[model samples]
Target chain A: MTESWLRLAPGFFALGALAAWELAVRGFGVPVYILPGPIAIVAAFLTDPGGLGGSLLATLTVTLTALVTSAVLGAALAMAMAASRLARAAILPWAVVLQVTPIVAIAPLVIIWVGDPFASLVVCATIVAFFPVFANTATGLAAGAPEYFDLFRLYGASHRDTLLLLRVPVALPYFLAGLRISGGLALVGAVVAEFVTGSGGFASGLAYRILESGYRLEVARMFAALVLLSLAGIVINLALGAFGAAVLRARDGP
Target chain B: MLDIVSVERRFARGVVALEDVTLRLEEGNFLALLGPSGCGKSTLLRLIAGLDRPDGGRLTWDRGRAPAAGEIGFVFQDATLLPWASAADNVFLPLRLRHVSRAEAMPAVHDALARVGLAGFESARPRELSGGMRMRVSIARALVTRPLLLLMDEPFAALDEFTRHGLQADLVALWREIGCTIVFVTHSIYEAAFVAQRVVLMTPRPGRIFREIVSTLTPGPDLRLDPGYATLVTSISKTMAAVLAPA
Candidate 1:
């Protein structure tokens, strides 16, 4: 009983906090436009579940595509940098430039250049997500113990073998860490890009729904959309964390 | 079966690590390079192992040319293991690099671990083993390929006395069983005297071979109490102090 209670502590606290929030909103006679209660938000959510769900799915699809693309590109770039000093010197500056440059500023140019709205949004989100993977993986690749290198050299291991077997396995945890960070950032970037690229022709994202609800003074609907996005971010983080821990446990010791 | 003819290794900024060091590696013998820190004992071993090149002289092999790095085994001061891999996989590394699959390399891997007294700890990780056990795993990895030449660089320096003693005895037995040439490097006089048939004392800094002693005392459990063993240890202690003492 105590174990289950401990496990559900966060949920109980959330419910308590929501009850308090709902009471305060009702007691103060606050307008729905100003601060919607939990009940009002749920009612708003039920009124248009299909439309809101579609928008959430669209945003999720864009975020996931960007995340996967960033993972592959980031890993490839990091490996190249680890392999050659020349490549590291040349590519690292550009990657940093891309990472530091605000995606908001670049989104307009990306949308205009790419022509397709979904592809442009993906490009913007990928730009925001790939940096951590590159930086962490690069550090990990260079962080091999010097003694291990000597051991490899003593065995006359080919450079390819050293990189693939020794260096890549060493970098796995670091890459996973980067991927975890990228997961949240990918969602943020997708939402931000959708907010910027609000054309009506393409299927709308949750960000567009939030924008539309805000203009129409449907604050309850906007809050409902936010709940879905927050839940998505939480799921992504928990899933990645569990996966990384499992892999490390299996490879390393208990 | 190997000859290092006046080999000299100089690092950057005119630091002569080894100068005019010549040694012949007698096959199937346990040899120790006994010296103080920075005495280039390790440098000499590296030159012999072809991990480093001699600046002054060349090394010639009995097989007409130097053996390939893959054909020799080396052990470091610490058990340099892949923490992510199991003990068996760690032993399987050199063979893995040679493209031997785990299934194909299983017999050799199992034999190597068993020879080191680690029979059922094949799936155990490095962190799961004790320091001495980790070193045993290291030795197992080195011998898995059954290389003719094994170069060890202060492999047991970090172990406790009891653990060190146990490993020292096992190493001698392993050396005899395998019948391979070993150049064991250590700063411990007792260790050098205990494990090796031949001990070469080296000077500090610009390392040079100061003296060499050949002992016929057979190493076993009672070898530590042998008067001849105490005499050998005492004989080297004076030089060891000289190398370590202030000039």
Candidate 2:
């Protein structure tokens, strides 16, 4: 019973905060154009569900696509680097360089060069999220216990078998940790890129809606879009955290 | 059968570990390499196990043929159980590595654990078991493969006297039942006397066999605390003291 109550505490706290914010804004008679109340944001959200929903869908699709691409490509690169000392020496510095270079600076350049807004945003997000997975996996692979290798040698295990059975299993927790970190990074990268490049033809994401509301001086709607983006990021982080925890628990067993 | 013909091993940086070691063991015999610290007794066991090669001389088998792969099982001073695996899973490691499925090796694994008096502790993790139990799990793992030769390097040296004695008696029974060759390395005079059919006493560093004492007991549980056990222990202790005396 106590554990269940503890789990629900965060939801209750969020509700209280929202109630307080709405009361304070209404009591102060704050204008909708300045600091909108929670009720006004909700009203704006419900007023045009189709427009908000479309933008939310667009942002979700771009972020998830970039996240999946980064995970697969980054993990493969990490494996290749771990497999070859020469490749690690050559490629790891470039991966670091990509990580440190801000996506905001690169987004406009990518948009101009790639000639496609959506593709540019995805490339930017992939760049942002790739390094954590690569670095963590490399460390995990290299950190396999010495005794396990000795056991492999004693049993005459092949190189492939050693990697598959021992090294990969050992590296899994670290890789999942990296994936959790990258989940939020991918969302941030997508929104930041969209903000810099301006969402293009056929679709606009939450960032573009936020930008459009700001230009039109619809501050309540802008606040609503911002809230949606923040919620999406929080949800992604919490969901991935739960996923990584589940994986670790399963490996540990009952 | 295994033969060590003048095997001499020297490490890098001028450390001589073994010098001119020659010994021969018949099939299914129990031999203990007995010595104090830094005597390379463990090194000799490693050579026989083929974990390390001799620097100077060759080790050979009787039929002039190499032993089959997985023909030797080794138990280190540490239990060396994989921390992530359950006790039964750890025991099944050797079979799993050989491409034997868990279902096929399950009965043999159970029997080996039973032989070590760990019949129903299969699901327990190593961390959950006591010291004696963990060592039994290691012994069971070593025996599960049914290797032609068992190489144990001070396997029970870390255990308390009561646990060690219990294991020594259990080991004698297991060896008699399994009928496999064993080369055990230990620094304890009492342990060597208690367990081995023949104890090969060694000199200090750059170890060579100083004496070989053959026991009179038949391979059974009655070997311990026999009347002759004291005399044999005294003679081996004297031999070790003389070997340890200043050059």
lDDT of 2 by residue, A67-182 (tens): 89988988888888877889899999999999999888888788888777778878888889888888898888877766567666777777677777777778888899898888
Scoring each candidate complex against the real one, what DockQ results?
0.65, 0.40
Score candidate 1 by lDDT.
0.91
Question: What is candidate 2's local distance difference test score?
Answer: 0.86
What is the per-residue lDDT of model 1 for residues B28-124, given as tens digits with 9 covering 90 to 100? 8889999889899988888887777888987888889887755789999999999888999999999998889989999999999999999999999
Name the regions of candidate 2 deviating beyond 4 angstroms.
A1-34, A81-91, A112-115, A200-203, A248-254, B3-26, B33-47, B53-57, B77-92, B100-114, B118-137, B157-164, B186-190, B198-247
RMSD of each: 2.4, 4.2
What's the lDDT for residue B163 in model 2?
90
Candidate 2 residue-wise lDDT, B1-247, digit = tens: 8778888989988888899998998898899999888888988887786678899888889878766656788888888886667899989988888899999999999998999999999998888888899999998988888888888999999999999988999999899888999999999998899889999998867788888999886655666658788888999988878868776
Would you list the clashing residue pairs of candidate 2?
none
